[model samples]
Target: MKKGRIILIDDDRDHLRAASDWLTVNGFEVLSFDRADDAFKAIIDQPPDLVLTDLRMPGVDGMTLLSSVVRKCPGLPVILLTAHGDVSLAVEALKRGGEDFIEKPYDAERLVGVLSKAIEKSRMSQEIGRLQRLVVQQDKEVGSIIGDSTAIRSLRQRIAALAQVDIDVLIIGETGTGKELVAQALHYQSHRAPAPFVAINCSALPESIFESEVFGHVKGAFTGALSERQGKFEHATGGTIFLDEIEAMPLPFQAKILRVLQERVVERLGENRLRPVDVRIVAAAKTDLSAEIAAGRFREDLFYRLASVDVRIPPVRERAEDIEQLFRHFASLAARRYGRPEPQVPPSLVVRLLQQEWRGNVREVKARAERFALGLDEEQPQQSAFSIEAPLPERVSHYEARLILAALGINHGNTAQTAADLGIPVRTLNEKIKRYGLRYSGET
Candidate 1:
């Protein structure tokens, strides 16, 4: 590896030659200028890693050069050279903008030490700036994958670990389980986060256009190929391409995807030249891929190529403990979206929220929360008492059970208090509690 470049300037012909030669021998790329004007132009064009200037010169002396470098390249280091008698001038220059000063007849070892230390500091500062920007950008993307459950936390950690590696990822989950959110997390947290994140839904694309949609096409390749175009692979170079619902892709197209992953190259529909692409693959599926392979709907070889890492997202039913919290969070969001007052979650509603089977996972709960936030769940005049998923008799039973349990818990299992809360007699409330076989706050 080559050391950083150094710019050396002095009016002394021999001093310039000596300093340049010494730094070059010490593994630096040295540019020497007998006149400060020439060095100033070089610095303006492209600032070197370090600047070495003489304190006294005919025109554009060390102090002037140091001031100019400070303004142009704010963090750059400029070392001043001075005679032993001119030590005060060197000290003044250091206050103005000089990094350090070296007296005449300087030792080569000391000069090398000062220059190396300054260069290392500059490199460290640049690296810190890069990392700070990356953190701010990643925070926006990571905040969307919400949930404090163990499954969610573990999924975030795995996504972060996989993002750092250059491997294909297969995200498996049911519909509405936030598969797309997982994919975005992987792309935004990876080294390719700064690059474009292109997504395509395999199930939405048709067989007639799959080739052109994915791999681009040359002009006149087909009836609608009026102009040459780049495909998702070419567009996502140095980034990630999210292939959602990969199992929905036809078998023939699966063969093409396998080739792209294996070769890291693609060709336009009418072009013979293969274009090289550098992109990470993130595929998602809602079905059992192994079962699909057995049924001959999916290719085993393609699955292996894409599943270099597998990320399975658990359904909301498995995370039932998080339901109340998830519903409250979504309710707040719905209120913000509609510019309305956020509704308080009644205890009765909270009890019903916990009893849901959550077949649609987080998405379904969020929709129901929005209805509650808008006061449409209970108070809408045209709404039916029974949801389409349940019969009226079953829905009535569920409502009664949830209301009795909520009232019992809220009233500390006092029959009189529970009856008052439900607008019923104490005897009737007790009989209904027994009929439902319910337990509450004070139940043994």
Candidate 2:
């Protein structure tokens, strides 16, 4: 294995030599520098695995050098060396991008430990960068969408087919199903690729601000209106405006959006001027708009207008074959973000992942994969239901039973407490205990 390199900078020649010798003996390739300038030059010339610099130097101080290294090589791990009572400066160094700090007159063992951690962190950062670039490259090559499942492939095909056609689109999917991503794929792969892609969440803003947010507002239109502002529609004139959670838009706002769709024009708030706008509308909803219309929450006419080109993204559970592809994609992404090597998703983890009900869908899986990649739970047990060939409900029951028993054990066999913690009634808990025949210590 190639040894990690360390650059140590201190004006004290004896201290530098001692530290270098100690690190070298412990298997690190150490480079010592007496001047801050020399250390910075070495860093720029060939970046080290880790940088250790004294806080105070003769001319160009350690803080300045640390800052320079961080800007030049953001992935480089920098450890600041400060004397006792100068701990505040060390902390400030950390805020300015230094990874850690070692107090002066450092213990040999402590210094080594800190240096080892810094190097590992730096290595991980570098690895994450490499993986992210690979992901970006692969994304471009395979098109922006990230899964290899038949569902995703069909989605890509639809996007490609519809890219040239100028029409309103209605995207329907459950929350966390990457609706915006599909919208972007349409925009990026379309004739409007060069134009802006503006996104708005209809559920995020208040009803009062809806008009001003979607349509430009003139100066003095309302109290506290200091200056004229352009709405998202005006900003997205020649491109695309992605309206997420379109079902949440109130009736009046929906009417305005419908008019924009039909007339290709918008009148700014507090102004009678009708501005002609040429933009593609991609509206997304977590529920069926027709149902909302029937319930009087969404307008029927607006649904027809937006559904000129409708695309439904299936929930993750419905696309079980895509789970592993998505997991690997996220694993690679997380690896890049954390500067760690692309972690292998053990066969067991893949199985557990497939077994998950995934109510939160792809987003939840991405978050879990990220946590796993960061080594938060190295020995996390494989979920039993992931294997498609296995008996699913049986495996799920087995896992659930074990989990309930473990929770009961942790609660010291207190049925009421366990029931409360598990969000079930005491009667239900007692029934389960009997049904599962859970044996507790002190019980026959």
Candidate 3:
């Protein structure tokens, strides 16, 4: 493998040819020129790993070339070479952003070593800059999907990988599982990030205007078509079009979508000319598309086309351990948005939260958190009715239940630990839990 690409500039033809030949032999790709001006132009046009130029030249000398490179392409390495190697001249070169100074009649091995070091350093700097930009972009794009569960981690990894390759992707998840959010992440992370991200709800659009809305219509295409309008596909050109709830699209329109996807072109309703489109299609489905296809509600061919890549999102229950963190995250956001202090969620309340089934997934959790933050849950007096108006025996039972629930919450539903903390036997606690109809994690 080549060590690095070098732009060698020297007025001395003999020295230039000899150095180029030796460097080439030593696994360096060399572009040798006798004029500094020509070499500077090449550096600007197609940058090399390192620039090796004579300090003394007839026109557009090495000092001028070095200054131009430092001003325009900062961080690029430029090494000055001269037969008249003065200490002051070398110091000046260093001050002017030159990488290093070498006396001409240079030692071949030392020259190769210096060039390699500069190239490696430059490459490292470029790599670090690239990685920093990538980290910021990833955080901005995929950071919205908050969770540390293995499933979420894997989903993020898949999103990151899929974002690099522009292709049609089908995101499969239950309702309120953030399929559209995933599609947005894919669009923002891909090369088409700067372009428009047009999202359309397939189920929301009526069949009568589906084609015109998606493929566009020319001026006077119909009674209401007074102006030339760009459709969703045209608006999303050079970017992505997210078709949410794609399974709900009628079967007849599925054939039209299939044609657009296959041909990468669209014909407006009143126009005969077909305009080519450049877009990455990302479709989402809440239902099992295979079942839809089997029931003849969706086209099998369109399913195959959209499902070039399938990304399945795990429901909230699947990542139950993330519930507490997710709840807190949402509560904090709600607090900020409402300009209210964040509520402190007690351990017992969290236990009750974990007990209920979140049928709506993250969306349900967010709604609950918002209500909690706004103190709406506290307004439900009947919900928290531990009656003091009842008899002593009833009051005592309610107090006992509250203590046990709190203990269980603190111990994270460990019955044995709750029993120990409450100074009761495990069997006694189990009987009480059964009698009171209390929920606990370890109950089998």
Candidate 4:
């Protein structure tokens, strides 16, 4: 398979041909051009993974080409081929946003290695940027379905479609995977937005008071029924009633719920009349209702009634691309809640987070972000890098600088290796080193 695409520009036809052959042999798809102008046009038309050009051409020299490319395509790598005596000129090119310079008669292996690293670095930066932008754009949308991962986008589309149908929905997901949020999304997006959305925790409700709480009771219905009251179903008339943890619902109550779902009406405990309730039912469960049915803990008929339309939420691990965005959003909200300016998240922290299992899914991420916003590192609570009393942004910067310093030390001051280990681009690492006035052994 071709490793990547490369645009090779050289005024010398022989040199361009030889370089193209070498690169193609190394598994790169080469787009060779002898004119810088043609190469520039090609780059504009379709950007390549990397650009390799001779520094001193007759028209639109490599320096000029490099400038144009940097202006048009911000992160495209441009490596210039320089003659032996033009080391000073090459250094000047580096300052002008050129990625690197290759000495004349360069080793093929060294050139290939440089191009490979550049390509990988560019890819990483672009992916990070794309995910961050996705988080921002989706957060601005309605109903708190915040992510741009394929799983999440598909989930949102499914929710939107279900919202318009005005039918009962069954949402199954792992614990803390936002099943309730899905239920609410369905309710608010439906025609019942003008009415109440009552949520009931089936697992938390006691069986002794289930009837009084769900179907309601009139005066003198029970010992505590001193006055007439509306039950959850009655209160949610013309809206929705969310039954959360439906798998945990008592078996006997499941039949009653199924009866209500089937009949779309409820009878008060003291009355012989059947009251019509025009409310939608949205039930959520973290476990498989089929398994519950097999175990005889849940009623199969109720399961079928509730699952006319089912939605399964993807776990955090299944949509790992959304981790950074989710973490950032949570941190921002936590900061606002705590009356603190949002901390600047370090790239190192993000790298660490993406590697986590996040067994609690979004709930776990939100909790972690709250802790980070409070300037608390749960991993190393005893070894505090900065005081919690300090300004949050300042503390975050200090934490970021410390992480960079440690990574640099671990990589023996090799910026490229340090960047790879920290899961950031070498360019970003170098910028941070300069910003924090850090000393290192191998600068590049």
The parts of candidate 2 lying over 4 Å away from their true place are: 1-143, 378-444
**Mind giving the per-residue lDDT tens digits that candidate 1 earns over 196-284?**
88999999999999999899999999987888989888999999999999999999999999999999999999999999999999999
Q: Residues 322-355, candidate 4, lDDT per residue (tens digit)?
A: 9989988887775564455667888878889999
Stretch of 10 with least lDDT, candidate 4? 377-386
Deviation from native of the Cα of residue 288 in model 4, angstroms: 2.5
Top lDDT: which candidate number? 4
> What's the C-alpha lDDT at position 12 in model 4?
91
lDDT score, residue 215, model 2? 96
Q: Worst 10-residue stretch by lDDT in candidate 3? A: 377-386
The C-alpha lDDT values of all candidates are 0.84, 0.82, 0.86, 0.86
Per-residue lDDT of model 2, residues 28-119, tens digit only = 99889999998888889998898888999899888999889887888788888899999998899988898989887889999888888778
Model 4 TM-score relative to the real fold:
0.55
Model 3's C-alpha root-mean-square deviation from the true structure amounts to: 18.8
Off by over 4 Å in 3: 1-143, 378-444
lDDT per residue, candidate 3, 205-233, as tens digits? 99989989999999999999988888999
Ranking by lDDT: 4, 3, 1, 2
